[model samples]
Target: MQPLTAYCMRGHRQVEGWLQRGSLSILWSLLEAQRLHALAGDVAEIGVFHGKLFIALALSLTNEERAVAVDLFEMKRAPDFEQEFRSNLEQFSVPMDRVDIRRCASEMIALSAAPEIFGSNVRLFSVDGSHEYAAVIHDLNLARACISQVGIIALDDLFSAWSPGVSEAAIDFLRHPDNRDIVPLAISAAHGPLITGASKLFMVHASQVDFYASELMRMNRQSFKTRASFCGVKTLVFDFTNGVRKRIEFR
Candidate 1:
């Protein structure tokens, strides 16, 4: 596993967005580890509020890789979001050529010919778009369609009271037979007032669990020992002080 260096930590904090520092750390560490393991694929996100996390994904990409941003930028929920998104990316000096911004709802993008736009090699898919149950399920399906063999799909706000639907939808999707191939790797959450706080869930292929587990243990000693089983699925759950924890599971 690749260690989260000081420079990477600083870059994560420098980016402005809803992503907590700990979540950013985990994202950076995961991507770095993926790169080290030669898990080559494109990166993507569904709900880019501003270009904060999007920029982080962009920074992680190599010249041959691409990053896709899908969101209803001008919608009532976040008017002028695209403007800020563009500004932030520019401010961070992200290569505009490497990014493909899609201005539409996640459901719309999911229903379209997404693979043609984003390609079929998605190693990291971040689902932070709609908090509604149906929307979450749709996004997960889309993520599954494009995710590489060793790719990871990250679901945001899994346990946040503000969007309990996300958790319900994710659990439901996991239980469904159609999604049997998409297994959980870890659920990252922070220790906090349960309801208001949020958690991020990382998932991957069932066959890749041992690889991720070994790498995760190498990176964080505190994470390796904390294990649990859900619905017969074994998971490694890790909690951080900043209210960030990851529960990795396998089928």
Candidate 2:
């Protein structure tokens, strides 16, 4: 088990200001700093919200490792939001030369469609593109297909989604028995930034997730908030993918 380096910033870093606070950046950095040991092959961000997590992962890797940032960048709700995200990344302290920010996910996936993306070995993957069921499932297939051994993949908004399909996709992913191989890691405490005013539940997958599931649920469980500062409220999903693949086969 590697250590996710503890980052302590004196002043506020506005990586979030760049793209709706893409918390996947924090999770990816933690995974890179923590789990991944052998040299990683490639680092990718599926959502690529203005390059926040992309820049963070890019800055995290050594020059030799390739970092790919993919997003629509077309201003989802408005025409100028993506630029603001870009501006925020520019203002932050990130290494640009080591990073390659792609225009879209389809474009990046297109590169390896012929020979398999994993033939090159994917090291780190962060998915924040769409919380919808179909989108998440598509991203999951892509990530699983591309990721190499000892690779770490993270999905944004796994806990709380605007739509039920997100959680449904997640539940289906986890309950699968073939998924017994992958495990969960307890990191729901990190979900604080995403949920504005609620104590939520989420999942994390790792080699030890099965062992840690009880402890993690305890940490995020609504019933056990005895801390004086704790407030019982809403919860979200994280990485309940362990023991899931078989469930898919059964149905």
Candidate 3:
């Protein structure tokens, strides 16, 4: 086979780089900037790749705050996902004064891990471990249980087919009445269907023609480099008792 051209190589590198960084730092930064109460709750990360992001958060949190990290501490194809997350945290000079790493697999990200502690003050939760459907749901449910009241959980890979089940499970679960509190804070359009030609577009059970149109409209207006994402989700679980269709489509 002939040698690949420089342009093709560069494109390949960029794609690989994105997969490594996971979520944009700006999104996390915005969430962190919010005013938080002292000792409000714990800050946890299920997929602590290399602990860079985890370190970043730990460093930002106050001394009284708890930065609990859970990861395999083993690096895989995910370059940023360090095998030894603790080492990375140390390398980054992250003060462990408040950081507590569970050093466990995502299996810990379930109610079974700490059932009695359900609905605890887990102020912020970030999940980026498995890309499979079942795993994503487990993580989502776990995140739901841990998040504090009015807390926000950022679902990474909203745009990557590497985990189509993520968006699907999220939309489906959040559509339910029980999960009406889960809201979308800010969706990134960096990897949605409009830009990534995503084969699937997951809409919640309550999704309507107007909502669909609005999402599509947003996709169309976005710049070329920016991908259309679900941004923020507000739980508006409508009562089915009201004579309304489950789903609606508009021309």
Candidate 4:
């Protein structure tokens, strides 16, 4: 495989995944803001299909930081998904030792093992493991247990037509009395004909909501912006403009 030295939206598209183009910008903005705020921790993703988004998260790591990837790579359609995932990491210049790969179902992971497996300071945790309501809730609870004080959780398929269960699970998580500290920071939505449906919901500990929301607004000044009440908190909703969208188009 060819070597890659840097990570970009262009490079990320080359890897196969369901992540929307606009979501890439939002993830990058969150990661960048985390760095500016000096939040230090590991990054993890539950469903790492072919390492598409995982590769980007791994490349963002610094110093002793690591990335934990959880997935049942033995897919019925792609039996060799595990091999493909590792190959993509190598192609993207991510060191093998920097990643801790767990080949198991998300539900199989014990909540008690969260601290040892994910550590308590996971700065960014992506929950795309299973779209089923039960699985989504389980994965999200695991994320909450491992997330840092200011960490951001990226919950995927919240508004995807193919996965209505994911959205329902999100509501269940936010409504729980135990999850009162977690709040929606932003939601990716369709701004025009190019974008459609909200693809992801970004949540942060209540303490850092303002920080991330303001930072996102400052970074995305050129894009359309609006807000809506979600899970008892106002969330920043925006999409890329024609010019910004053109820049991320796969070449």
On TM-score, the leading prediction is 4
Query: Which residue runs does candidate 4 get wrong by more than 4 Å?
Result: 1-6, 190-198, 241-251
User: In candidate 4, what are the lDDT values of residues 1-251, reduced to their tens digit?
Assistant: 12222355468767877666577677877777766667789999999998877887887788899999999997777776888899889888897798999999999988999879988899999998878999999999999999999888999877666788998999989989999999999987633332232468999989998888887877665664678898889888766555343122111
Candidate 3 on 1-251: residue-level lDDT in tens?
Answer: 11111112132233222222112323232233332223255666666665544554565455466777766756555444444565655655566777776656676555766434323566567666665677777777787777665344656666465667777766666665776655454443343333332221222223232443343333222211222334344321211122212111111
Give the alpha-carbon lDDT of every model.
Answer: 0.74, 0.47, 0.48, 0.81
lDDT of 2: 0.47
TM-score of each: 0.87, 0.61, 0.61, 0.90
Better of 1 and 2 by TM-score: 1
Model 1 lDDT tens row, 17-122: 5675555656766776786777889999998877667777787777599999998876575567688888878876777898999988878764457787677899
Using TM-score as the yardstick, the better of models 2 and 3 is 2
Order the candidates by TM-score, highest first — what do you get? 4, 1, 2, 3
Candidate 2 lDDT over 1-251, as tens digits, reads 11112221211244442222223323433444332334556777777665545665655565476666666766556554567656655665455675566665443464346124333466667666766787776666566566655555665554464555655665566555655444333233222344331112223335533433443343334422222211121222333223101001010
True lDDT of residue 57, candidate 2: 60
lDDT of 1 at 180: 82
TM-score of 1: 0.87
Model 3 lDDT on a 0 to 1 scale: 0.48
Badly placed stretches (over 4 Å) of model 1 are 1-8, 75-78, 110-112, 191-197, 223-225, 242-251
